[model samples]
Target: MMHHLLFCILLFPLSQLVCAREEAFAIVIPSSRLQCYFVPVESANHSKLIFDYQVIYGGISESEENFGLAASESYSSLTVAAETLRERLIRLRKQLDASEHFQSSRRVYETRDRMLMESKLSRVNFWSFINLVAMITVAGLQIYMVKSLFEDHSRVGQLLRRTF
Candidate 1:
């Protein structure tokens, strides 16, 4: 009897369960200043345009508020005093270019100095120094031999010195 009651209780819940289909509804307001539409509740793409406009054109509202009261000619003069993001970027780019030029010139000079030092080091090695000293010593001995030969008055004496 207990098992039959348990079966009946489980079957009663399964019998009461029902399946339903999804339905959607919409409300349209055909006004420009107060426009509203159905957008996905989880997405923010609908508001991206406003954010982009705010980033690209930041000073529009300020200009309208301050310059709207003045004449059109004066508005241009006022705008000239205020630096926009574009002008700042241009100025920064020029500075960066100048810095790059300076760095390039410095690199060229450093490379030249390094090459000159390397060339000097290669030419003045231990073997070259030794050869230079040996050449000097041999030249001095040749000059001394020529002076002694010229001082000897007779060819016989020069021949004797050469033989010895």
Candidate 2:
């Protein structure tokens, strides 16, 4: 009797679990050291779009909101890169401001002394600006290259999984 009761309970309305599928997605944005991931409850193959934490983009019907191709192409990626550069620029500007403030105090000195100091300061500032900008540009490019490498790694992983 206990066995029969157990069997009946097991067969009871488990229909809710019958037709669903789960999928995961991951994406590495171009030119930045960032990646996004998503897991869709319904089959990713049935959806036309996907959304991740900070990204949204074109997708295949079977694509879930996972970190797949579409999500990487979203506008969020651009915003991230732009915002990063802006922050760096703001920091550099603050340094420039500090230098300017320091120079302003030298205004009380004689014309000859002030002119000489100003000339030296100006030359240093000009070179500093050039170097800072060049450094930032190179850093940004490196970040982009790293992100691209991440994408390649993920792709290789996927390929390996499928082939194995």
Candidate 3:
């Protein structure tokens, strides 16, 4: 039982790797006059379009067929490279998209913080103005009260002197 479980664990990942390697890709090369499509042998039947350029343009001579096979082998290697580059491009695009999303979220957070600070400052300024007005009104009332008391004392002194 222990050996069976271990084998299954290892086999699962190996199977997945094999499946990944079997993925098919197609490439199309087009010119003004003619176009050619390339696909790996595994996906030949499943291809959406397939044509023999040699047959279309002209029949393949023995020498030309040998040369074409050699060229096809070279192009197959190139296709593998192209598939690798495509995977890298897809990964980079995903990274770029993630970075852009992070930047936008940071901007939104910064804007929210700035608005909160501005709101606090506005409230402070409003309260400070109200406090200043209250202080000034209190000072004015005290000054008027003192002035009225002094004027009443002077009037009483003048009336007492005139009666004497």
Q: Which candidate should be chosen as best, given lDDT against the real structure?
A: 3
Model 3 CA deviation exceeding 4 Å by range: 1-69, 142-164
Regions more than 4 Å wrong, model 1:
1-83, 126-128, 131-164
How close to the true structure is residue 73 of candidate 1, measured as C-alpha lDDT? 70
Ranking by lDDT: 3, 2, 1
**What lDDT would each prediction earn against the true structure?**
0.56, 0.57, 0.59
lDDT of 2 by residue, 1-164 (tens): 56434332233222111122334333334332333334354756565443322223322232332555465577788889999999999999999999888787665456779789999999999999999999999999788655655575666555655676
Candidate 1 local lDDT, 72-107, one digit each (tens): 778786787666756998999999999999999999
**Candidate 1 versus the native: TM-score?**
0.31
Top TM-score prediction, candidate number? 3
Q: In the order shown, what is each candidate's alpha-carbon RMSD? A: 21.3, 38.7, 19.2
Give the clashing pairs for model 3.
none
Error of 1 at 36 (Å): 37
Worst 10 residues of 2 by lDDT: 11-20
Instruction: Residues 14-133, candidate 3: write the lDDT tens digits.
Output: 111112335543222222233323335466454443222111232234444343457778999999999999999999999999999999999999999999999999999999999999
